[model samples]
Target: MQNVVIIGAGQGGLQAAMSLRQEGFEGAITLIGAEKGLPYQRPPLSKAYLKTGDADALSLRPASFFEKKQITLVDGTHVEAIDRAARRVMAGDRSFDYDHLILATGTRNLRPPIPGAEQALDLRTLDDALRLRNALDRPMRCAVIGGGFIGLEFAAVARALGHEVTLAEAAPRLMARAVSPETSERFLALHRDMGSDIHLGDPVCAVRADGITLKSGTEIQADLVLMAAGVVPNSELAASAGLAVDNGVVVDTRMLTEDPAISALGDCAVFPDPVTGRAVRLESVQAATDHARLIAKRLVKQVDDPYGAVPWFWSDQADCKLQIAGLAAEGDDTILRPDGAVFRFAGDRLSAVETVNDAKTHMQTRKRLAQGPVARAALEAAEFDMAQV
Candidate 1:
């Protein structure tokens, strides 16, 4: 049995440890994290946790599970550096050797340069969420920067809480990087219908204590400002240790880095897309957990399967639930289904399907993608639903 040392005790790192044990690998597993307390899910920090404030519900597994599984969890300790020559990791003054190392450090919210930007809050980690939650206790006009998933999610929640919410995006549409133009337009209407002042293609130039001023010189008065612009991959540790870092820690199809002794997963690692071979870093809980399981299987049971799992994502904005089954690159053609579902096609191949408030369709599309490809003619036939297709 090999000794596995996992960095970043987030969803991915924790899953890697549990998956290793589940695969019946009787080996030493150490999960190191910089965050204090237990590892928690960050997605709900902006969605459910904003309204509920349940820290217990966010945890992936309790401390007892880690102990019972013999998974050594080291919390509140930052991994200072990596000694590649000795295959050891430095956390403060302590060091731990490993037969294999998995880096699942995840990503941190990108705080762009704006005047008095520190006054703006973030919605990434648990601490950020808690601070924002506490700030929401009093009635306040809030301006949210960025139109990404987390930003939009926060905007939706804030608007529901009777806060004067203004959502500003540098891009013309919401979730520009991930979702299609059609989906972006749909969400824009939804948020606007809910009385949110949504600004597109405009970035905030300054974040004053009282309000935010956009680049166009339009001032949006608000009591709170949330900076949800985007996230930068936490790959500095891996990159510093001589691993390739392009946007994220570059890994092969097997999720192994150039060193072979080290592997990276979750939002921090850039791996080749199973279908397109294009390098991409995903920030979904599904991707993180699945990537961890893939690495675990490879390390333990010697299941050398390529990372072929289909990519899927979900975002809850207000009452609408946006679900995407696959990664439809920018150039993909989107076909609007009869039920308002959007099916994306890259040339003749099915690229992705975007559905709002349609969990069944989402699950079916994901299953179909896993079942392999369907003919373009079959999809266009209308006789074949996503399931039969």
Candidate 2:
């Protein structure tokens, strides 16, 4: 390929450009981003960024790295549309022609249609975090919508900073979609012990300037409201280009779209699960970087291997650092070990392992899962000892 054009200059998009060069591809590379400034890490936006307010530490690569790598970095430019027939992308008056197109368009925060929802702040981007951090300069009552990672992490930080926090979740448990009931209950207690009011199974019906009203008609007084319900994939660009889109842009095991010249990855692409063959979309940094490397190798070295990297994720809330080694379904069977490791089983096969403040177990679980599925019978024989298994 003479020219590779990647849309969305987030982690995946930037990694694609870097990986292309690392794989010895001597081609023109263009990385387009909607946000101004160098592409920064998003995971820290909810954690350390809120406390330290260090925007410089979040940069994935320095400005000199981009220039030295001979990669064209286009910031503050929103791609208007893709002319698939012409194999060119239009961004205002400028156009970029690509021998191969990589769509790394990530997701945006999902704002519920509640009245005054737009008034609430977000923690998705660096600018959003900066706004929230500035607001925390003075002690203020905070009402956080959503009990997921972002909301909980923010609540922990706010409460530690001596602000009154009230967190509301639509689900009955914290991080219900991602964690086991045991793990959810543990975090529930963790947040409550940190002095934040936790509301379960009660979503915010309306967001106001002063506070938020729960579905149960309970109004919590607050000076600040944060919307962290969830996120929606940025697949409109690919959908307009006539590509199949489900929850995200549909890609194969190779992360290739229907058109041979186009491919999608990261939160924007829904590819089949390496283990289950089920369509899944992940929004973690690991998935984005791994997918980018796989795509780069395929383009430069003609490596046709399918994407099978083991999925892993982490979240920092207060003194707890929760880590998950693999993807687990809601219906997966859970086995909580005495050491606080939660093992999830899909049928008889091991699906995932959840650990809090246990990096050793987390890494071991990822290595074991990457090797292949471990049988429940074997775990039972080993008395739930991950090392023995």
- lDDT by residue for model 1 (1-389), tens: 46899999998899999899999979899999999988888889999999999988897887789889999999999998889999999987799999899999999889897889999888888999999999999888989999999989998998899888898998888898887888898999999998999999888999997899999999999988999999999999998899999999999999999997899999999999998899999988888999999999999878899998888898999999999998988868878877889888888898999999999989998998998876678888855388778
Candidate 1 segments exceeding 4 Å error: none
TM-scores vs. true structure, each candidate: 0.98, 0.99
How do the residues 290-372 of candidate 2 rate in per-residue lDDT, one tens digit apiece? Answer: 99999999999999999999999999999999999999999899999998999999999889999999999899888887888
Supply the TM-score for candidate 1: 0.98
Stretches of model 2 off by over 4 angstroms after superposition:
none
